[model samples]
Target chain A: MTITITAFSKSPDQGMGLARDTRVRWALEEAGLPYEVRLVSFRAMKQRAHLGMQPFGQIPTYQEGDLVLFETGAIILHIAEHHAGLLPNDAHARARAITWMFAAVNTVEPPILELVTARIFEGDKPWSKERLPLVHDRIRNRLRQLSTRLGDADWLDGSFSAGDLMMVHVLLRLRLSGLLDEFPNLAAYVARGEARPAYQRAFADQWAINKPAAKAR
Target chain B: MTITITAFSKSPDQGMGLARDTRVRWALEEAGLPYEVRLVSFRAMKQRAHLGMQPFGQIPTYQEGDLVLFETGAIILHIAEHHAGLLPNDAHARARAITWMFAAVNTVEPPILELVTARIFEGDKPWSKERLPLVHDRIRNRLRQLSTRLGDADWLDGSFSAGDLMMVHVLLRLRLSGLLDEFPNLAAYVARGEARPAYQRAFADQWAINKPAAKAR
Candidate 1:
């Protein structure tokens, strides 16, 4: 059965692929799977129907026939589990690939989110100027450790899997911060993921919708 | 094969069982699996060996034979995948259970962590009072959505799975704020999870180690 997922009617990111559905879309595109998107306003997201699908009323919930899934990690993992090209065939390698997936979301993304919060939500706070450098340093610490581990390797692990997909997405959030430039190898790693034809298609698709909205305003 | 997991050499929470390792311990107890804990200091968590195991320099990493896994969601999911009782037998039900696991971490925990940051890290700030409500409201909004979906339902889905384990743990963070008291149903839901003997045993085990440290100080 074909799948359907949800996204912001008007994404806050303005088509930067930071909306997370971009990752799902990119993954599906990479897997050569066609899918549908249902736009959810902030209001509709909290409604009974949406809450039935997503406990926390967040975006990019996946549905296939009677099966409904939420949480970007879970949704992406579900897709990778049922589809090909997203995971390796070997058992040990596959486990390692899944490890990377967890690392991306659970490990890498937290500091990035902290950076976002400091910049966006706490921007006006007096301490933001002082606090941001600490957050940036934390991010750099993670990047340095990751860069060290990933030294001279193309992907975090062997041949790209869902883990690389997630790590790339997590790292992409650093683009505007310019901190990514500090780690050229990590920057190139993100570039490699973005350069994937599937990623390009997904980016173009979402960007197509986003650019016009920006223009109208 | 026996499994080895990490815990705080002395938890900052004293005996409160708020530490991440307690979650893994609870999962292990619930699964009726035997395991050992390797208490690590903050310094050890950042050391090369620990960093090799956990990229984020956090706790509750799982090690079995040659397999090592980090991220509580990933670890719990792995345990649930290998052991029965943590997942439903039906395919669709299983997917939904896993979805809740993601929701607990990605959606619910972020706002709760905000509350932590505000209360602990930025408590001295002039804007702490104003920002605290915003963080609390964000948490309440999540709980409201969750409470509405739960209604009179005992568990999030059919049976108690690792998903519920995660959801309960995430919700438990709000206990001190009394915001959880605002949702009696969710509070009771958390109570039920805590009442589990497995949870009790896990709590005591961690507490046994943590309590003395608090007293010594």
Candidate 2:
């Protein structure tokens, strides 16, 4: 069965590999799966076909055989469940890993996203500049806890798993805000994730598509 | 092993059951499982003991035997995976259902939590009134897509699985904002979820803990 996923035809990240398709691609690489990407322009992403695949009109929708899955967490989990490399064999360890996955998106990402909205979407608003510090603080609170938990640890739990993959990506967004630097351990943690062979391959794949176009423009 | 979970000693919602614990409680109920609840004060939630179980220092950690799990999405997923009722029997369907769970928390709840932040945490800010419309519009964008996907359907996917349970609870938070009312179909969908015996039991339990305290205060 051919595995196909959708990504931005031209990513707004401009080859930074922050776009979520990199997450799915990273998971596939970690799982040692060969998959195809179907690029969708921003306009086409709003069209009926793309909306049918991803109701949220976002990239990184996955398909294999008859199964179509959206949501990066779910896609990563699906791959992790089917493949041996991304999850632990121990039942309790696997459950804890999944807990970290949820913590990454739900608890950690929300504040980081607010920072994005503050800086990008509403950066021009009258409040954007004023609100930036508050947004940063909110992110800092989460990072403080995360940094405490992750101190001296290679991963959130034992060994690198999908949990680390998700958290590292979520924290990578903080590079622009420079918040991840406040916690040196977390910065090192994300650096470790980026250094992973799988993540390097995924980053390269997204870069291939995004970089040339960025230069052309 | 006895199943134990934590909740707010006194929930911020005044017992409307908007807390994440209710989501887990609802999942447990749907699975026909009996569980014990331990109440954690907001101060204690930040303390070392609670933080040990939940790194983010938020409630609704699950403990069974030696395994401790936090994050409502992961806890509900843990229950749904171990139990028979909360998930579909078919593999593809189960994956799709889990996608909705991720969609609920990752995609849907982020915008809603922003609304909460705008109205509650930053309500006194100079820009709160001016900024609220943008936040509301962001939410409307998500709900519009969700409404389109959920058109004339009883659930996000087939049956009343954990996905619906999650989406329903996520949407339930919007009731305080009254945004759910704007989309009649979604409102009805949430009503259907609330009408479930399990959700009712979950709600009543939280209400019992919260309502009398509100009156006394």
Candidate 3:
């Protein structure tokens, strides 16, 4: 069956591969699967057709024949479930890996999203600058716990499963804030994920589509 | 195997049944599974022992024999995967149900979490009152999308899968904010979830534990 995934027609982060689609692409790459990218314009994303497929009007929606899925966590988990590269064979280990996926989105990413809101949406507000430290503190608390859990381990659990893919992607968002540097192991862990061949290909592919736009600006 | 899950020794909402454990209990009740609770003190939550099972030191962690799990989404998904009542048997439908589970947390809950942070952590700040509308609007956007999707349907997709369980629990957080009332259909949908026999049991079970503490306060 042919696989097609939606992505931003116009890159939000220039060509940095910070968009959610890049992680989905990385997962597909890790699974050694070839898929087509369906670029969706921001306007089109909110239109009826897209919303029918993804109620959230977000990018990185997966469509394999008649089956459709959204939510990067779910999409990644789907890929991992079908592919050998992303999850453990053992039942308990697989469950633990899935736990990390939930933790990455629900536990860790919320604070980072708050940080984003503080910087972008509330940036012009008088309290934005002053209140940012509070948001940072919250993000730091999660990073501290995650770093402590990770330690010097190569991955969160073992063998770089989807859990690591998700946690690494979640932590990657913090690089712009520079809080990741505070935790050396976490930073290194992110670096290791970036160094993966699949991630490299995913980055390069998105970069190819976004480079001209970045240069033009 | 006797399933044991962790909960807060002291109820944060004073027996309002807002604790994460209530949702876990709801899942267990729906699955017709009896489980024991291991209450963890706030101070103990941070200690290495508790942190070992739950890296982020959060509540409603699941332990069944040697299998230990954290992240309520993960725990609930695990229960659903193993039990008959929580998930659809068809593969694609099952994936769709899981999609709602992720959407409930990753999409809908993030803004609610921000609202919590704004109210609790930043409430004393001068901007708190003024800034709440922005947070509320973010939540409203999500609710609008979700309400549109839910329409007149009693559940998100069909037949009260784990997706509905999670979405119901997530939306339940907004009842105090009164935003849920704004979307009449969504409010009714949440009420339907609470009206479930299993949900009633879960709420009662958590209430049983927290009632004494509430009276003491």
Top-scoring candidate (lDDT): 2
* Segments in model 2 whose C-alpha atoms lie over 4 Å from true places: A212-217, B214-217
Q: What is candidate 2's TM-score against the reference?
A: 0.98
Per-residue lDDT of B1-217 in model 3, one digit per residue for the tens?
9999999998888788988999899999999998999999999999999999998988979999999999999999999989999999999999999999999999999999999888889999989989999999999999999999999988888789999999999999998999999999999999999999999999998888888643454
Q: Identify the runs in model 1 with alpha carbons over 4 angstroms from their true place.
A: A124-130, A213-217, B213-217
Where is model 3 more than 4 Å wrong at Cα?
Answer: A212-217, B212-217
State the lDDT of candidate 2 residue by residue for B126-195, as single tens digits: 9998899899999999999999999998988888899999999999999968889999999999999999
**Full-model lDDT for every candidate:** 0.85, 0.93, 0.93
Model 3 achieves a DockQ score of 0.92
What is the Cα-based lDDT of residue A170 in candidate 2?
93
Candidate 1 structure quality by residue, lDDT tens digits, A1-217: 9799998887888888888889899889878999988999989987878877776777888889988888788888888888899989876677778778777876678778888987888899776787787679878988998888888888888788888999999899999999999999999899999999999999988887665443554
- Report the C-alpha lDDT of model 2 over A107-182, residue by residue, as the tens digit: 9999999988887789888788888898899899999999999989888999999999999999999897789999
**After aligning candidate 3 to the native by TM-score, how far in Å is the CA of B14 from where it should be?**
0.7
- TM-scores, all models, native as reference: 0.93, 0.98, 0.98
